[model samples]
Target: MKAVLERKSEEALNNNSSIWRNKQFLLLIWGTSVSNLTFSIFTMALPIMIYELTRSAFAMGTMRAIEFLPNLLLAVFIGVLVDRFNRKKVLLSSVGLQMVMILTIIVLLLTSQLQLWHLYVLGFILYTSAYMFGNAYHSVLPLIVDKEQLTSANSVISFLYTFVGLIGPALAGMVLLVLNNIYGLTITAFGLLVLLLFISLLKLPFIKKEEDQKKTSMIEEMKEGWYSLIENKELWNLTIMVLLSNITSAATLSVFIFFALDVMNVIETKLGIILASTAIGGLVAATVAKKMTRWFTRGQLFIWSLAIQSLGYFLLFFSLDWYWLVAGMFCNGLSGGLMNIHYFTLRQETTPNHLLGRVAGTSSMLMKLAVPFAFFGVGALAEFIPVHFIFLGSAIGTALIIVYLIRTPVVYMR
Candidate 1:
């Protein structure tokens, strides 16, 4: 009788349109907005700072590789941990660890004792926590919202992210002008502190697993996640598409600072403005993403999104001016915003509650498997090859994958 009542209650919430009023949802979005805004500043500044410090492209590339290495090495295991542990504990612990890393970086920077190796080790740990937090973050949403509202909830989150992207670079650029990396990261540390408070206030719904399932070993749990991911054709195909696209993106983005600093000869402020302008496209796409999924079949939207990104890469490849590069980033942002909304919604809607952590982890690991290699290789190759050529290769690679997806009939598009 209690189970029936709970089901009816959930159904009512699903049918209603007051997701905006959801206290847990609102807190999560607001807190995320703060952290993302600050992190955007840190991301834009880090590569430039490294280049200024070491003057070595290889070092920069290595740092980028280190940042994402956790996605490949630890994401799956951490996903299992998120599934097995209390989510609130996971969120607080991850954010807390991230704050510590940021504070450490800031201290080193101020003392003029910061080194490349410090960035490497600290970056690895920070992003590892980030990935853990990310898995737990995504896993928690389904618990708080109705299944039917997944798209709406994810769209809202994506919009906040895109909105931050739109403004974050410019803000970071301004902060860089008045302050420095140390000051910028000070803001990030403060934001994480606030994020911890909001996380502590969350009252997530409880999920009960079967006694047998709970008793399974971690290895068995991981295998269960891998099998669950492969069993869903649409989800598996989407994961492959993202995986390939990330490789192309990594190739272009990893060297873009060199492209901008050397080829474009733009200053930091201008570069920030250029990157921030690109987010306009994403912001627009985020607003319309839910409607787009409804207007187009899931497969159709996926194709269109990737096509837009490929076009953006072509623009970058042929860029005659900074404006052209901005146009390229705009396309990338638009497609990314669209793809992520549907992709996340599908994952949330399709996967079982008990396995959300593991599946999210496994899928993320698979998506990022090639990224560190791409970053390191591009960094090494940039020493001999022109950065613009890398852009061309990315465009070509992206175009080929789109064709492959279209031609492959075994993968269902609808």
Candidate 2:
């Protein structure tokens, strides 16, 4: 027992070293911040844009469905590609594709030839590329940092994402107002500028992979990833947890815009403020997650966060006033941030470094596979059921996950 304890302590020390603080990690973080900022802007703005153009909830749902479709269709293949190639190259190439796609969309929008189909096509392409890039990014994280620091490293990433999210939506709202008065060319131009800067500033130092020279076909590589996940009990359990969490989260997101616009009657400007408030709550939660994890077991953390979010969802369901809804969103955001830190860290720590990309991809694929269906279902349900009941249902789904966790052996191992 003493020997085992000592070994664990040593591993922890090694993980906390400055050697894990490489220049590559810093560059990657900066690049991610820039890219996510732009991504968040689009995430918040596009829904509003579609609503304004069509005023149809179905249209908004379809747009979301298009964005998540790639995760369902190409996730496994993307995972295989990430594992087989130079991950850095894969990352850069995916970002480059996004840059081109965004530029094209901007041009079309500026030319005033932007049809709804154009928006759908462009959004699909961008999100597809993002899914691929995200798979590579998450997979490579374990390679960059030591195993013990996985939690800390994930916390850092989540904190950055939360920070960007906080500013991105609010900025998008302001930009929308500014661009609405202009020729619309200015918004496109500014978006192009942000994309260029993000791509240009992205610099990754070379690092050797464990399977650097191993030649494997994509099909074989994909099979290996699948085998790994299926064989690993911990990984399989974690994947299940992720899938349940994602379903609830996606449902909430699918209906959130309608709630803000139709239910709360919030205009564009105040809507931005509310978005910022939620993001700020996430940022605050992420900032303290590391400390929280020190006191709680991973299982405990997961259960508590889910419970908090479930409660928040219930509040949202009952909230009639704008301020009350915003408060509920804020609570949900905090739970989201905490969950992000825990989920990513758990995945990184449990998976082997060589299979990180494939595992990450496979796991992402599973979680996201349900997203399109969730969006469609929620959208359709909203047409029939009251929006409040949808929120209540999401909360119930989240609660079910907690109950499953309590009964399963998933928590004790990690």
Candidate 3:
């Protein structure tokens, strides 16, 4: 009795203390920052590599379309797996799988056997693993931190990653210009290796399951997740809102590489600068996100963020020069950064820790349902329409989504 009481007392104290003092949380952030840095670099390099290989805007869109398929197909099952199994092990395994895929990519590159098809297949596997890691990682955060600290914890994590983003793209550009895609990817592989080490050292508390409860089947578990999501009016509505928003984002982003290379006539280094500009907005959002919450409800933030994003897209629509495109990218990143912190915090705060994996997976699956088609459609359209028109279309779509959101009870949510 005394030991249990003392432990509880200690935990409460830790929970109330500063987030930086939490060793496990810090470790998680450090590891994730390294991985995000590499992923950012990979993101910059992959499109250029694909473009160089195929030189078709539609091909890049095809790659983007393929990347989201796993989310649509496998996320629900992966959610069940995360909730039932050890989350740390799931995270580690997912990271390891991605590393293997990256290594395979490196091998193909070195041997001069890399093909567009190879990227299509490997990218699917890699992103599937990334989805698994994301589910487990989201589930793990609630386990490690207190409820009151969620927003702040999320803010800190976002800030670090955005900071990484601020530099990672520019660095990737320089790396690509000077060395080659292989060297940039080699850095990514190394960061993942280091991430494995950090994750291994994390000592997460085990979740206690009720012994009297009967074991549920996987199908039943998935249904529970689905119900949990749809049953929540705010979450379900926001999920729909995000679904629309993602489509617009996908459409614009699908042809951005082409916009840079063909339309703007920029080289790798300048392209990186434009891409990295988004991170500056992200950095600003991360810095101010928590403070802004005190002044506005979460719902207000959502609407405003979407509004800002719409403005950003409109900027892109009129961007006759690279700097104008840079401005648009910054707004897009800023809105994304602002919304993500609140979005994740709200989900974690509302869902039971046990259901976090399932809910996250299902919601993600739902949000991603239309993205692949959007990618394909946008890719096809890029061949006919000017890229700026896609941005114009996306901006209009986002405005309509905002109108839809304004009519919902979502605006009333705190």
lDDT of every model, 2 decimals: 0.84, 0.74, 0.87
RMSD of each: 3.7, 5.2, 3.9
The residue-level lDDT of candidate 2 at 374 comes to: 86
State model 2's lDDT.
0.74
Q: Candidate 2: how large is its RMSD?
A: 5.2
Question: Which candidate order results from sorting by lDDT in descending order?
Answer: 3, 1, 2
Clashing pairs in 2: none
RMSD of 3: 3.9
Model 1 sits at a Cα RMSD from the real structure of 3.7
lDDT by residue for model 3 (289-386), tens: 88998899989999999999999999988888888889999999999898889888989988876788999999998888888779789999988978
Per-prediction TM-score: 0.84, 0.80, 0.84
Q: Indicate which candidate wins on TM-score.
A: 1
Give the range where candidate 3 is weakest over 10 consecutive residues by summed lDDT.
1-10
- Summarize candidate 1's per-residue lDDT along 263-362 as a digit string, tens digits: 9888887787677756777787778887886678777888888889899889988988888888899899888888888899889888986788999999
